[model samples]
Target: MSEEVAPHTHFQYADARHQAETALSGMWLFLASEVLFFGGLIVAWTFCRHWQPAGFDAGSRETVLWIGTVNLFLLISSSFVYSSGLAFMEAGNAKRLIQCCVATMAIGSLFLLLKFYEWHIDISEHLFPAGPFKINGADAGGARMFWSFYFVATALHAAHMIVGVGLVGWIALQARRGAFADGWLTPVEVIGLYWSFVDIVWIVLYPIIYLVGRE
Candidate 1:
């Protein structure tokens, strides 16, 4: 019999294909947990929407619909940036990877700008939940409840965006130093998955928060 090929596995860094598959598997598992977490919010939203349909609808109308719509587009574009970034990193194009990171962060910043403006309008109208929550044109208490939920949920979403921006910044720095030049693109790919998941959360939030009451 021929000599056996002893287990050379210890000398090998993990199999690249196996590593990528594992990365994707872990990401999907994490995403599943995220879906469940957000699912609870949707359930609560449904209950409120059922109880106070008019109020919910009216509150949604009060929002600058165009603002939320534009933000949705911005996030979708950012997801593309992160996706392309992953492609570039995998293909060993460090410069392109950095470009992608910049683009993603820029788009995320645009979302925050629009969000801040929306908050400004709401606050100016004495429509903030904590203090003056008077809507001159609707059932004030219901409107207050509606805006209360709106403020809470969207604020949380914005905080997540902020965190995404920070993570992307760190990714950018790593790319600049040729950190991903070798077969070490795993971290970048995993973080991109996280960024996309964050974007997906907002995708669901946008419609529920802004489209529920629209005619």
Candidate 2:
């Protein structure tokens, strides 16, 4: 129990600590469910790779490594910046929070741009598994499966990034208006959690999608 304050913006609970705990718990629950969903994709990837290691490796080699590497750098850095925004919020520095949020969104958008560019390169190279895939021979099917998994996983990740960008922008707008001061920092904290989750998924994906076949 703590001193009761008037109902804040998002949290109706008067106890500040209770509100923080509730928000954190809710975010963890949501992220846990997301982890389960992504876990299925990883399981599928494992099975497919086990079945056709050569094909999987071959498909991995065809991917443009540099772009993926760059995107990973951008996303990881953006998450760090977003974390700083959360720190700023905790310190009651709305100005820094807004700046960090905007920077996070910009970096995330750059990652998405680079990702799409790589996808475009993939298309140009005829790596897309659109039935008549260029990855010919007996191992072609396995290679196609690998590419399919790659597309699905990356697409889902990009969608999540897009949503994160929007959320950061919204938080920035709110912060600009002084809406997040006086202990109303739940939104910043929870959104940073989400952004960090997305970055972690990409961290896992980067090695799987880029490093596996190189060896």
Candidate 3:
């Protein structure tokens, strides 16, 4: 019986293990940059909220709480499912790995669907901070600012979710083709890191968008 050979390492790497470590390190660096980007947005939001607490609170109150909460759960669940897929790959269970990837994709898709619906509702209610805006108060200008931040932040996060869903689907297709059977699971691990990072971003955004100023 011949032992299975791992996937070929790129010429730039010393070996398969070296290649994997390099890939992981690259992902971490990418995510670190992402952190700074999102952190800037968060800081901007905090400053705006502090300046217009009433308006921020009103804008937050208009958000669809149930949809945001449910989407949060979906993202969290998708992350778990993707991680389970990684574990299955490590265990050499290609079938289960494929199943988990598909599940994660489905969950991510549902989250996007719900988010779109929520956006539709917000638009219809004139919550978009544009012409015919619904939020009017002593601090209507502040409220408009809040809605601007809301749209920008949530739209960015949703874009990330869209990418994550596509990646998970791709991973599923690759797993079905037995691409990771030889223990060359670097792709799976890297995608997992990306997916988890996106989920964590939403986790941070959830409270700021939904729970924080609603009281």
Residue pairs with clashing backbones, model 1: 57-213
lDDT of 1 by residue, 147-181 (tens): 88888888878888998899899999988987777
Alpha-carbon lDDT, every model: 0.81, 0.89, 0.90
RMSD of each: 5.5, 2.9, 3.3
Q: Which ten residues in a row have the lowest lDDT in candidate 3?
A: 1-10
TM-score, candidate number 2 = 0.94
Q: Write the per-residue lDDT of candidate 2 for residues 46-161, one digit (tens) a residue.
A: 99899999999889989999999898899889999999888878888999999999899899999999999999999888889985687899879888988999999999999999
Worst 10 residues of 1 by lDDT: 4-13
> Pairs clashing in candidate 2?
none
TM-score attained by model 3: 0.95
Give per-candidate clash totals.
Answer: 1, 0, 0
Q: After superposition, how far is residue 124 of candidate 1 from its true place, in Å?
A: 1.1
| lDDT computed for candidate 2 | 0.89
